[model samples]
Target: MAQSPGDGPKRVAIIGSSGGNLHSHGGDDPARLLADIARQLDAAGIELAAVQFVAAQSSMDHASDDTAATLWTLEPAGPAPTAQGSLSEVNETAGEHDERLAQSLRSGEIDGLILVSADPSGTNGKAVAAAAEVRAPASGTGGTSLATAQALGVDLVAGSGTTGTTSATRAVSYVSGLARRWGLKYRPVIGSGPSTVAEGSPWRRISIRGIMVGSIPAFIAMALVLAISKIPGLDFLSPVFDTLMEGLPIVVAAVAARRVSGLGEVGLVAGAVAGILSAQGGILGGLVGGVLAGVLASYLLTWTLAHRFPATTANIVTGGLAGLLGGLVVHFALAPLTSAIGDGVKTGIEALVEFNPLLAGAVAGLVMWPAIIGGVYHAVILPLVLVEMGEKGHSFFGAIDMVGLVMVSLGITLANVVLPRSSGERALAASGAAVNFGFGTFVEAAYPFLFADKRVFAGALLSAAAGGALVGWTGSEATAYLPAFVPPFIATNKLGMALAMVVACACAFAVTALANLHHRRKQRA
Candidate 1:
């Protein structure tokens, strides 16, 4: 039950095993173990909250020691940081050790847990085993101890190693991996500590990366709508998918709010309010509203806390004020501005296509892949495409994307699978291609080869440019992002779109296969 600062890093509890057949299993050492764990967590932008050592002295009596006297700050733990001095060598036999652990899990304070137990029969091991049987609340089942961790959304990682340092290191890797996947970063505590350094330009993380993250659910919903339309009975569920698509703004706001403001309840409330009020403006509006709300709420909360306001009262004030101010700003000012921008973008593209369709198409196709690489396709280009499709029932940009990016990527993947240097590579390439086809929202299937050689990527881009030129010439348009096989069925210029895709695929395939062959020959020489 240690206290953390208002804007502190994530708090993780460390559980360790001791006593009971300790020698038969590797002996538990306090020195260097907690230090390594702390250091690892710090590197990942997390902080150690508390450490508890459990000893299963007998079936009836268990001994537990709470050794985390020092409040582990955000500083990196030195190499020799030890728990020996502060850790009570208390062999106090208690039957309530499990209850204490369970209480910690039930409390909303701990953000994550690390369990270090080599033996399955040990106290720590037993707790871990019991957690496996407990289902999250979403599944409608629950258990005690570690089960509480699962239900409460506390991330848990079990370490794997004979020694304490090795096991802790392994566990830290999992925590780091999860943080990376979620785009979580450790930042300095606001207000009191050293001033937090500013992040990179808004174009990189805020506009591009944040919008991309927020757009994922919408993209998935779009894919589902396309996939379900082809299914027989599932067409009835189209409304459900449509509802999800309609709430795209809310989804974007939620993600944006949580990312900008910590996972505070206030930020979510503000984001939702802003999103609901700004729904007419689409994803662009949501992005602006959510970021505004989150920034306002975060700073308000900090100021309230600094003034020693009650936590609950501070949170209420923050959410209320942020929602009111942010919603007003978006509704009266930013929403109309964003809508105008989206309209202007669509009109410009349409005019370009009208003037010289071939050149326009070629240029669009050539830039599409680079934009994806530069992280601008989703943030800047997608909102325009979505707006166009919503108003006109189809999008020319979508047509270009399908053939130039998706189909070309597919072609590169097929080439690798067909002319792979090894069996493993062939298998990998095939699976990657299958995944790309199944998802139809990304071109990651081509990433391996794209990064492996510049020539192959250049060839793919050129082929896409040529295909795009044809699409422009034919004036193809699509209502959705579809797989290679499905696009022709839904596109405005069916035969033309098909032809463009085929040409793009064929050119990409030949270029990639030849590049692979050249590389192989050079290796032999």
Candidate 2:
């Protein structure tokens, strides 16, 4: 409960404030930084709460394809420069600094706040300064640069406009100093970036224009659309080619991707197609589609190259294909249904925008769960957050727009429910949790309780369906702050909005229990 930064006696969790570092993919400095921080915290006998990191940056013109610079900020839970990262690879992967670490943060559970590696400035410093100058437009130039940054805060500010090493060093100094003045307690770890400072990999950042421009709000508006979509004539998503076609490029590319099992021209072509659709939506959509096409095609190609392609690569490949297909359905079939609902309760639905906290909390809780909650959290909250002050993906609106969360969430939750309590279950839970937490950002806590009994899936699946239906019915926008690479629409309060899920859980529990009992009785007979 110690509130000050660098306070003693607490577990320190290091939060990565930046994205992939393109500089040296061979050497994982950021990951080292995280481990080092964890070691220090553990050594201190204090627990690390959560690490808040921000990788915000800016570019001069929208057209320049050069590296976009970043302002990487890491929040640790102890003293500055107080014994950070290990020099070994054992402490590198993500699991070491998760959950137990994050949970500590949520409850005011930290004893100290340590600042680790707060690097500033980059090649794009000039452009960033220019952007900052015009950040508010009417605000004028009285420290417009600093003022813009101050108001934008660490979460919102990006220091990617620097020209080279010198400016980057200067900017990092200014940022670190300003942060300390603002009480951020960081180590100011300056590194080299042709484009920007990186947390780990250089290729992980997303172009967030679409969701940043109101994806959550837009999708919240769309959630209403989902509700109405349930109405026969109101569903606009059903008959449209967009919803289903959304998955097409991936499907088509899957064929070629699977052919070579490598990130061939087909994969790049898929990426291009997705990029086009995203540009159509704005940077938000572009980032989502582009990332998906890149990752999927790239991964498949890797597998193809290794000559160890999965026999079921087809299923995995089709999953991406299914996304566009689902989109087409939502646009063409389900969309009109929403219109019908809207017509009936247009006034009522419109009046429901009070930003209900209970609903928000529940949705947030769902998002906080292991699978969809934590894994995909990056994708879910990124669009809205812009920074952990910003680290995440799809955001809120991006969440609802993409059908991926649903597919992934269902896979995860169901896996939790259906799998027996064995090493397989444990592995499934781990994978599911990681996917939802690391990649999808959907739900988190539910897995444990649901897994308490196998019958839990019936309730879990039913609840998941209800939640999905609620989202679909409401047309709630989801992709905002984060990028899932596969496109996402989960939100911060996503946990709260998944209310219908309660009933689904109840249904699943009932069905599962009854079936179990029935099987038992038959055995007795």
Candidate 3:
């Protein structure tokens, strides 16, 4: 369902099937209301695939007159709809308009469905009553939608009650349940469909692993992950994890256990082993132990899922990424590179912890971002590379943390694969990639302003590389895990590394933004 582990994306759609006569909160027509709603949702992180207009009348006059400005991220190929409001008037009957709705549903090309004022009966209370034929189909229609959605195995719902607030609650509840059941952590943000309800969760879409992506496959994968986690054996702290690992040799080539999603248990083992290794022998343990654990887990899990869900371009990509990047290779690799790229920084960090603890701690706090970037890379990207690399090291699943080397190498071969198309997107994507590489986790810190109008994804990388470069130059080192989005683990030479990191991040941000602005100006001309 998702792309490779290192890859992150958000995609969504919005539509209103309410009768054309429905009033906007501010009294604008449905089309105008829709434009405003889509804009608002975009701000909240739900990138709309399209803002469709279904109203009193359907014609080119309404479609051509769409004045809503659209949003274009640094990533998307082209401009996105802002006021892309169109008109779809009453059709002769419900069955006649089935294709229109079906086509609308397909346009989003997403995993879940979001309905605005889903109750057709409530939407055109007066109109349908006036037209006996239209009214005849209303009540029965809602019942049919419920049955069809269930039979099709599609989880569909509206999001408002007062303005359909009940639908909103229902949608959130259903979506959350789906995530829990499947262990698939993905939240497809649907804004203003049932009205502009602010989301309680900080992330619009998040997986069982707590990562976010709006893609359909990603969501399904999340569901699968959640389901797998519940198995008696997959939970790391539980004895089941040990039992499963011990049985790797036997079950390695046989069938999988059923309690958890076939693969979640294996993922848990890999992740848990990686954690244990990191704590045991520092970076070396993390890389080597993690790879061994991951390889073992994959063998067992693969045996289990062999015929059921099987591996895919995406599944292998995400898990393999986690194996290689999150634990060992990068952890150890960075330590060695200190002399060349990050030099005196390490000594400075060490000294701070040893001598000037407070100041050093503050510096560590500052460098915390790189630590997070670096850490997230360990947790995600490495595992993916482990599977994709599929070379001699294929058996060494745990050490796949070494596979993170591949993501960087991809720059030479597949750099353009997930790279931002525009300057803004590049800044965001780059920052995210860099942050993942340097600090260890959470792409959120760099995602904003990435698609914020101009293409800024490239800027993120410029920012990240700068931070990483400084770490290389200063030779700053983190002890435990690179402090994630929160902070770094204690270390010496903290202040120097932190200062270097700051300068690098600043440089990256400046360079990327400048380049993007220049590009945009040229394009406008």
Give one digit per residue, the lDDT tens place, for model 2 in 13-55.
3333323231221112334434433442332244544543322
Better of 2 and 3 by TM-score: 2
Candidate 1 deviation (Cα RMSD): 13.4
lDDT per residue for candidate 3 within 1-525, as digits (tens), equals 312223332333333343212332211344444444344334434345443324433221233323322221122432233222223122223223333434434432332333333333432222222222211111111233334333334333321122211222223332333233333443423334333234422122112121111111222232233334445776553343334323222221111111011134334444543443243232223333343434444343233222232122223432444444434543454324422322243333345445644343334333333433456534443322222111111111111111112122122111222433354444446555565555333434443444443334444444444444444444443221122221121212346444544454445445444654566677779
Best prediction by lDDT? 1
* 371: Cα error in model 2, Å: 7.2
- lDDT for 394 (candidate 2): 20
Alpha-carbon shift of residue 194 in model 2 (angstroms):
20
Each model's lDDT: 0.59, 0.34, 0.32
Model 2 scores a TM of 0.24
Clashes of each: 0, 170, 123
List candidate 3 segments past 4 Å from native. 1-466, 479-491, 523-525
Candidate 2: regions farther than 4 A off: 1-170, 173-201, 206-218, 221-443, 462-506, 509-525
- lDDT of residue 134 for candidate 2: 35
